[model samples]
Target: MKRFFAKKEITAILFIGILFTLSFFNWRSAYATMKEHTVSYLASAGNKWENLSSFIMDVDNTIHEQVYQKYYYIEGYGYIQELLGKKEINNFEVVKAKDGTLHYTYFTSGPNQVTSLVERMERLKKAATKVGSEVIYVMTPDKYVTGVTEFDKGIPYNYANETADNFLQELEKKEIDTIDFRKLMKEEKEFAPDSFYVSDHHWKVETAFWAFTKFVEVLEDNYGLVFPNKGEYTNLENYNQIVYEDSYIGSMGRKEGKLYSKVEDFTFIYPKFETNFYYYAQNGSRDVKAEGRFEQSLAFTSLLSGKGNIYDATNDKYFTYMNGNPGFVEVNNFNEPDAPKVLFIKDSLMVPVASFFALGCSKVYMIDPRYYSGNIEEVIDEYQFDYIFVSYTPQNLTEEFFPFYKE
Candidate 1:
C-alpha cells in the first residue's frame, strides 16, 4: 500500500512537472494549436447549426411556397454581408489635383458638397474659357433616381436630385453652358416604365437612342453643329434579344444579394452606320483600335461590350481599346479632314453615348475620372479642342465631380 501510494504521488508530480515544462518551453505553439482547435470546433458547430437551421427553414419555405408565395429573408446573413461589406471597404482613393482640390478616387467629400461642386464647375468654365473651348456640362441621370428599383430606399439622402438641381441652378446663375438631362428625362417619361433595364445600371439601347437624340439636339442648338435627325438615319431593328435572360445580375443587385426579379427580355437596335473608332487610355498613354461592329447577342451590346483594355479596329473585329484604364479617351475620325476636335469628360454613363458623338466630332476626347490621373488642365491645353463636354451620372456628380474642382 505504501509503495502504491508512493508510486501514485510520483506519477502526479511527474505529470505536473511535464505540463509545466511544456508550458514554459512550447507555450506559443501550444496556444496556437489550441486556438486553431477551438476555431475548428466552433466552425464545425456553426456549420452543423446552419445545416439544421436550413433544414427547418426549408420545411417552412416549402409550406410557404405551397400556400402563400416565395419565402424571402429581406435581411438575412448573406444580405448583411452584402450591405456592410461594401460600406466597410468604401475608402476613397485620394490623388493631388493640379488645382488645390483633392481628387478623390470614387466620389466627392468635404463640407458643403453642393457648393464645392458648383465652384468646381466654375473652375472648369474658367479653364475652358482660357483655352477658348466651349464647356458643356451634361448631367446624366442615375438609374435609381429614375425609380426603376426600390433598392435605393436605404440611401441616407436624396443627393442625386438635390445635387443635380443645385448644380444646374448654380450653373445657370453663373451663365455657364450646361445641359439638364434630368429635365429632358422628365419630359420623356413616357418610356421610363420600360426605358431602362431592371438588371443593369445602364439605360437600354433604345433609351440610349432617345438620349442621343436629346444630346444631338443640345449640340446643334448650343454649338451650331448639325447632327442628322433620327428620320434621316437608317434604323436597324431587332438586332438581338437577351440570350441568357434571368442570369444577369447588376452591380446594385449583386451588392444587395436579395435576388430580386430578373430583367425582362428586350430588343436592342442601333443605326446602320459604318463605325470606325479608336479609344485612347489616359493611364497607359496608349491608343488602340475600337470595335466598329455591333454584336446583338452580348450583354450591354450597344457599347462595344468588351472588358479590360479593348480597342476595336475600323473593321468588325473587337480589340482592347485602352486597357480598362480610366481617364481620358480620344476617338478620331480618319474620314474627315480639319474636323473640329471635341473633348468629353464623362463617367461610365457615357460609354453608350460615345457612338453618337463619334459621328459628330472629328475627334472626340473622353475622360473618365475613375481612371486617368494626369493634369486635366494640361490635357485640355495640349489637345486644344473646340468643344469640351462634361457628362456624368447623378451618382457620379454627388461622388466624383467636386474632387476635380479647385478649392
Candidate 2:
C-alpha cells in the first residue's frame, strides 16, 4: 500500500514537471501573439479574456501552419478522391469535362446583395453624371457560361452565371450604358475553341484581344471616338503570342493539386507593332513606372516579356498582363497625345483589356476599386474623364466592389 502511494506521488510530480517545462519554453512565443500587453495579469476581466483569446487564436494558427493542415488535410482527402473519381473538396468543387476542361463552382450573391449592388451603381451613375462623365458598366462573363460545355455533365449549378444575368437585367431597366461580353464570347467560342483557358478561370490572351476590339467598337458607336486605323489595330497579324506548352497549373489546379487539374498552356499576348507607351502604376504608397513598349504595363514585365520561363506558377502567367493588383495604372499613348481620356475602374479580369483602351485613347487611367480609397467623383472631376468604366468578371460581381459608397 505504501509502494502504491509512492508510485502515485511520483507520477503526479513527473506529469506536473513536464507540463511546467513545456509552459516555460512556450510562454514567450505565446506571449508574442497577444494583441494586448498588460504588465499585470489581474488587469480587468474583459482585458484578460481578450488577451487570452488572441493568444489562443495565435496558437491555433501556429499549429495549423506547422502541420500544413491545408495541404495535408486537402491533399490526403484529394488522394482518396482520385481513387474514387470524385470532384468535391472542402470548399472547392471542380467539374471535369471529358475534354479535359475544369470548371470551378462559384457562390453567387443573393437577391438582397444584388439589389444593394444595383442601388450602389445607381448612386455611382448619378455622381458621374454630376461630373459630366458617362458611366459604362462592363460585365465579363464566367467560364461556366462560355458555352464550351459539350463534355461538361453539368453536375454543379453555376450561381455566377444566373446572378450575372439577373444583375444585368436590373441594370438594363435603369437604362445604364453597359457592355456585356457574355454574348460576344459565346459567339466567338463556336469558332475559336480556346476562348478561355482549359484549367483556369481567366480568358485567353486572344480572347481578351477580341473583347478589347469589341470595347473599341462600342466607344466608336457610343462616344464617337475613332481609332484612325481600327481595323488594322484589331488585326491578329499585328500581335505576337508567346505560347508555352504544358506550363501552367491554374487557381483551380492549385486547389485540387496536380492530379485532377494538370498543367496547361500559358499564352502571353503582346503587340508586335511599334509599341511605345509610358506606363505608371501605384500600389498603396508605392508608385512604379515603366516606359517604351506595351510590356511595361504587364506584371513581371521582364519575366513574361522574355526574362524567365513561362512554365512557372499559373499566377505568374495571369499577372504578366498587369501584375496581381495595383491601385491604379495610367497608360499614355504617345502616338495620340491629344486624344480623349478614359477612367477605367476594373478588377483583375480587365487587366489584359486595359492596354486595348490605351491604344484607342490618348490616356487610360485604370483604377482598381478594391484598393483605391479616393472619391470617384473627385477622380472624375480632377482627371476630366470623358468616360468612366466599371468592369468586373461575373464571379467578382458583389457588394464589396462598391463598398466605398455603401451604408
lDDT, each prediction:
0.53, 0.70
Model 2 lDDT, full chain set: 0.70
Clashes of 2: 0
lDDT per residue for candidate 1 within 1-407, as digits (tens), equals 99999999999999999888755544443444445544554566446665656455644443433321112232243345444533211232222122211222344242235666777878878877887888888877655443443322222333455667777788899888888776788887733535555544556656766687678776777777655434443233422323333323333333223323232444434435454544444455444445444332111233333232111111111111222224666666554435568877776656666655555556777777766677777787777778888887665665464456575
Q: Pick the candidate with the highest lDDT.
A: 2
The C-alpha local distance difference test score for the whole of candidate 1 amounts to 0.53
Task: Give all TM-scores, in the order shown.
Answer: 0.60, 0.76
In candidate 2, list every pair of residues with a backbone clash.
Answer: none
lDDT of 2 by residue, 235-289 (tens): 7788887887776666666666666556677777777777577878888878878
The alpha-carbon deviation from the true structure for residue 22 of candidate 1, after best TM-score superposition, in angstroms, is: 31
Q: Runs in model 1 with CA error above 4 Å?
A: 1-112, 145-157, 190-193, 228-244, 256-258, 261-271, 282-288, 291-325, 403-407
Write down the worst ten-residue block by lDDT for model 1: 311-320
- The TM-score between candidate 1 and the true structure equals 0.60
Which candidate tops TM-score? Answer: 2
